[model samples]
Target: MRRLAASLATAVLAAVGAVAVVGQPAAAHGAEVFPGSRQYLCWEDAQTATGQLDPANPACADALAESGPNAYYNWFGNLDSNGAGRTEGYIPDGTICSGGDRGPYDFSAFNAPRTDWPTTHLTAGATYEFQHNNWAEHPGRFDVYVTKEGFDPTEPLGWADLELVGSVTDPPDTGGPGGDNYYYWDVTLPADRTGRHVVFTHWVRSDSTENFYSCSDVVFDGGDGEVTGIGDDAGTAEPPAACPDEAPGAPGDVTAHDVRATQAHVMWGVSQSGCVTGYDVLDAATGDVLAATDGSPMVDLTGLDPGSTYEVTVRSRNDHTGAVSDPTAPASFTTTTTTTTADNAAAAGACTATRTGASACS
Candidate 1:
């Protein structure tokens, strides 16, 4: 999920050659709690390790110790498949982060009542962009709640401890290939609340009984999205050394394929070390990252302006170590106007089928 920062110049759209643009047919997966979520913050900590699931933050390390690595691996999936709006008695206290025992994967350790967990800072009464990972995107409403004033993090969290603050249905998507994949919307925090609190999110899917949940730690300490407790030495005993980027070896045989008006294909040989976890394609003209891929040697570059000359380069990536290779020498390609025949237009307008045997579009 972690990659080098890219510019927001490309238009957002669904995956190419994949059916169902929204509400993906796959199982209802998890989301990111904008600012920060337990899983997300923990996932960020784990990426510092060169190999294995080594969390740089102490609390994150404790989470990994308590729950297995799968907690971070499946960070986007803290879901209960049949909650059906029964939250109070249905989900038990102290198990909010893991959604009780519903998971075939155990995330019970994430519910450990601790004040030292990673926290995102926010300004009260401020309208902020809230985002959630859209892994296998689903159509749903998000029920967001925050703990009451004077809520203690050391104590167990119960429904009584929270008050509903925000509710959004089918929020818009800030399309990108960042933070795994996510849904985005804006929400204003309560003006009267202050101090450390737990921001709970419940995603109710319209397609099925499957729902997702999260417990994001936050503080109203006048911070402008500056995170504490993980990277900084705020809670940990020993100050950890900054993680070094171990860039992968430069790729070979880089060539342009499938050049089109709005899209182009680029492929290259794998890194010699075979340690390359992914690839990032960057615009040579603008220096913005165009697209990224995990294992495929080829990537389809979209959102390009037609009749334009594009010089792009590819760089290998290692997600675990936060490392990226030097950009390959630029490969130039010119795109021509794409002609959309009646068949292509009709295909584009047709409702895409989903795994649940339903259409995602009207």
Candidate 2:
């Protein structure tokens, strides 16, 4: 792969060190090229609130058929250890997305020749920041390539078909939660490039000989980061079947804690049904409102009297419509008595049962 030149700052290199994990193959760490790679976008399309792959897009559904469910689970890691920068000769022509290896096997199906794969729309000759996920941090260089104009998507992709657009070593780590550090660099799109093309990324690890490969389907129209073929619409891809409308189911595993002098904290599981948008908490003893929330699973009952017994009940709600669920069997808890400094000393002096059921005190 050719290392195309661009003036990247050394300060960007310093940011790479902060994220670098001491010992691990770049295997744990990989990229999701934006506009977006096949696996990355498909993985996003298939995911649900329950962490299930309920594919909403047709191309993603087809990919699920080819690669199976486990492939998307490891979406970022499309890599080959022995690549060593030999792009064309080492990796076979059509199997570029899978890195020409079956070691991380399920990805091979993504290399299937097809034109209907999910695509990201872009404006030609426009400058845009290329974003990649730093799953597990590593010291490597990103080599970006774009398919030449007049490249056909119906056929398999090959090295002869692509042109090296730009390369950057240690791109700045734009922060993201839970190690999804997005590395970004500004690259000007090819002025002559137009129509359907692939933005290929080659991540060459400086720490090891291993290299990662990705294929991002793209169309050079006049678009600006608006992804199609996703969401509730049946725009080229068929949307999943509609969920039936009913009252949201009750939340499970309700619990209470922090039974302090004046307040108690309560929480519960989110309802399994998609209809649940929020929850209504009630005082189980008096059937009065304790608290209600549209967001969090937890709520604190404040202004509660000390040494009082209080029970809180939770009900899942569907905010879209005015439907509330049957209340969960109430989680009953008693508030602890308010204590003074003298009470602490008196309690400490008294004997209490130990782990062995024997009495002990200081």
**TM-score of each prediction:** 0.60, 0.59
Off-target runs (Cα >4 Å) in candidate 2 are 1-22, 176-178, 234-362
- Write down the lDDT of every candidate, Cα atoms only: 0.63, 0.64
- lDDT string for model 1 (192-301, tens) is 77899999888888766777888899898776676777654444334334334555766665777545554455656545542455666677666666666553344544
True-vs-predicted CA distance for residue 67, candidate 2, Å: 1.4
Model 1 stretches astray by more than 4 angstroms: 1-26, 176-180, 232-362
Could you give candidate 2's per-residue lDDT for residues 286-333 as a string of tens digits? 666556655335544444556867677888776556688888888888
Candidate 2: worst-modelled 10 consecutive residues by lDDT: 13-22
Best by TM-score: 1
Residue pairs that clash (backbone atoms under 3 angstroms), model 2? none
Candidate 1 yields a Cα-based lDDT of 0.63
Output the number of the lDDT-best candidate: 2
